[model samples]
Target: MSSPASGHPSPPRRGPRIAAISATIALFVAMIGIATSTQASAAPGCKVDYSTSNWGGGGFTGSVKITNVGDAITGGWTLRFAFPGSQTISQGWSATWAQSGTGVTATSMSWNGNLGAGASVDIGFNGTYSGTNASPTSFSLNNVTCTGQPGTTTTTTTTTTTTTPGGPGPGNRVDNPYVGAKVYVNPDWSAKAAAESGGSRISNQPTAVWLDRIAAINGTTSARGLVAHLDEAVRQAAGSTLTIQLVIYNLPGRDCSALASNGELGATEIDRYKTEYIDPIAAILGRSAYANLRIVTVVEIDSLPNLITNVSPRPTSTPNCDVMKANGNYVTGVGYALAKLGAVANVYNYIDIGHHGWLGWDDNFGPTAELLYTAANASGSTKANVHGFIANTANYGATTEPYFKVGDTVGGQPIREKAKWIDYNKYVDELSYAQAFRQRAVQAGFDSGVGMLIDTSRNGWGGTARPTGPGPTTSPDAYVDGGRIDRRIHLGNWCNQKGAGLGARPTAAPASGIDAYVWVKPPGESDGASKEIPNEEGKGFDRMCDPTYTGNARNGNSMSGALPDAPLSGAWFSAQFQELMKNAYPAL
Candidate 1:
């Protein structure tokens, strides 16, 4: 939820490269054994080559080689297997990969997809291995089993670790159902909630914390920094019915066009993403103790949507954005996270779909869905991986655009009857946008069982009782006719606007197709600083936060004026927090 609205100036570069791959399968071919396809739907006569490089330290690297021996894999190929070790993928590339317990999957990358009869493509990953790293015995592509030599079989032993839960001193009581349904909260946000109390209703309002990176838990040690955070969530609950929420933000080349919340990783660091970030987080989550808690992971915000909405026909100069498109980073990253975490029973994965103002038009519907479909279908992504999607995250767009309808005609006609900017899809509100996105996603091959989530934390700003008058008139109107939803001086303003109020309270009960309404964006955390203030956190300030900086013409960030009261990217702002509570829709 860090980067706001990003608009790319060019159109998409289409067409596929029809090049043949060579000489890459030798590594797996030399050491692997053969196995037949076990998939019922697989084509006959397919075979696979499986092998593990070795196991050392706390991990080892592994690879899979699939050979299509029958009809061409015209519909694409998916390679699947079972890990015979305590192995977990930290990062995977070349194809989309996912692992749930002992099982793993890798779907073909666009360039390497569709292996011709007798042709093969190789895929591999660096995985964390605690015990024996036995090479898996079998492999299959497109569900047909591959014939190869299975690795050596061995006996195994198991171990368990336990910890006592205790916290929240005298007078602070707690109670809750642990029937394995706890939502772990980040300790940082919990402390912020406490500190913001005192005469502030926000103190009473429950909120989520932002995990923007692989933070140091105890003065720089333990890949288990996430484990430490979850530990805090457990202690804070003190056996209460209250659940915690953690926001896993921070993708390399993060908010492409925006400046404030740019992350530590670059678009090219695919290996670090696996070794340093995803693996440890997966290890902690895979533990049985944390299995019952409801761990809602807001996977890589501000990513995928950029591929469709922020790419340019003129060729983008932004290296990360360019690399992202070329390497399929966003699609791969989200698929990896979904597959990894989705393996856990209690964890819920929700990929972020940018707000209606960003990808709500007719042109956005199909591509956005296809993008989601690709990520969901990536090798490792299981049927259970992406349970739902979250929309309008971190933006201030209202839940319902009451002024427009699906077929409402404008300028004496229904849709596009006047301005070239308008259309007939009626994505005038967040809910309609979500519904339409859900349908397109299904058509694009996502499961119909998928659900939806919306970030309603800041959208409910203008109600009937509220005034279109008395707001910051000098600031740009978010909407067009009169005082509409426009937040800053123009279209696509993402900074803390001058007059925006709080929206609906967090609710498990939202409209249908929506699993629940969530505050994916923690309120009062400045989108970015007013100016570049020297700080330990690398969250830099952009001209978008300047008081007089007109706007970022290159990226179209028109929310130019500084929010006099806001702070930097992840800090708490008392004034803004108070305003949110005072202007709350349910009336804090």
Candidate 2:
């Protein structure tokens, strides 16, 4: 949901890295002692190092490193263990997991089947527990017991303290990068914002740097290249911990469902995307010079969601979308990006999931989770590669609809059922959708510790026209239309919305399951040109960006609600900037 569609020439970079650094220090690593039991006789020998990050609420993520101390199990091997308490495995990765009663078995995958002597493989799982969550005292590799150091048993407890913000600390991979850290302000965005009237209020905020095209990797005439941004981030850090956000867009045949923001790469040009796009970015990110910074990469917005909602068999299907789905390029490209970027220790990958309005229905919700899971495990990637997800990027879904709930009734019917705008969708805003999606993601095999981010750059629907109270209950449509904070003519209208405002200021840990509320979309950037003004950026004019756009099936045949006289996507629009400031929810 970014501006400049295909070639995202640097937008306003508005999202500040508002990460919440927890005052309460988290116990990162807990190591337990194991006593060898008779079960050890079944196999040669092994050592398993198990650790977990407990987020409380009965959820925890476990990381296990299995080292074969004895003979190599050539063909395949199954690591078995039992929970000492009421723990239940909900999702796992790096190996195939199955549980029965208290016993659990993890079989090696095809790629990691053979184990040479002294070799080790790391695997993990997300689990829930009741009562007490205790670590397993023993594990068996290939049915043989894992006995360490001939009866010399000991336990290790490691505590990490938040160091003064600077380069990488002892625990480089903090549970939440935004926590206990300062966000890097993109000077490029700051300079532009400072030039706007009253834009200085947010000029210093951290916004994401979008590498929307191959040329964006290097410096475009209009924008700084990836290396330049990283170098600047290092300088910004000085000697403190800082977080930088980057949007890794540009999948082959990108934005297949929409004409605007169409990318340069062809459907079959997967190799070029890998080598030319992702590889260069990954290389720059992996450099030790910038190792101390926390880099958050928002992987491909508008790619996967289209596969479910706009492909063949759906009335809204597009021929280009069908081709993208058939070739599996979107899936392959996202997986490839996740693998490459995630390989960098400091990089955290948050895949983009379209707003609630786009996938809040029963059919779209579960399928989207499954599809995301597939992508996380595709292209030599694993669930471990994903850090979390971001929602409502470059869209106008409110952070919350305060006046009423979806379950509220009007005329004896659920508001969702009665309201023309909601149209039976479960969620009415981005925050609710993001939290719910996190649960679905964990159930779909992602880490339970995964957090969520919401792009609040332009969804704040505050202004004189803002609703003060719940709409009248005379009927569903009136109730929803009157009080709903999201003032878009239709839930599907996502371009430069007419009455949009700056949403919540970027902040850390604003809500449960949310890591931060970011300005990933860079408010004030045109979503797409209101009318076709051809250029070299690969952006096409879509009617959805037109002020008088009649309707589209995707938007329930409603008005586009976009502002008029907008420039190409990603190009700065001073008029939109003034509007965002004037209408900011928290008030500038």
RMSD of each: 19.1, 13.0
Please estimate how well model 1 matches the true structure, expressed as its whole-model Cα lDDT. Answer: 0.57
Model 1 per-residue lDDT tens digits across residues 1-588: 233433222222222211111122321211111223332232344555555544225644455666655545444456777877788987564566788988998865433455576776656565777766666766664444544432232222211111122111111111111223344444454456567654345544555555677664221321235667666666766765345555666666777766778777877776777667777777777677564355667777778877876565433345556667787877777778777767765566678888776676546657877888788767478545776678877777778645433333333333322222232223556876786576566556665545677888776664343545422323222122333343334435667655566787666635545666777677776777777777655576777666667765432434464567467776666776666665667666
Question: Any runs in candidate 2 off by more than 4 Å, and if so which?
Answer: 1-172
- Give TM-scores for every candidate, taking all chains together and pairing residue i with residue i: 0.63, 0.74
Q: After superposition, how far is residue 352 of candidate 1 from its true place, in Å?
A: 0.8
Most lDDT-accurate candidate: 2
User: Backbone collision count in every prediction?
Assistant: 45, 19
Sequence-dependent TM-score of model 1 = 0.63
Local distance difference test values of all predictions, in order: 0.57, 0.77
- After TM-score superposition, the amount by which residue 124's alpha carbon in candidate 1 deviates from its true location, in angstroms, is 44
Clashes of 2: 19
lDDT, model 2? 0.77
Model 1: residues with Cα > 4 Å off, grouped in runs: 1-187, 197-199, 216-225, 235-243, 314-319, 403-406, 409-425, 462-480, 483-491, 552-561
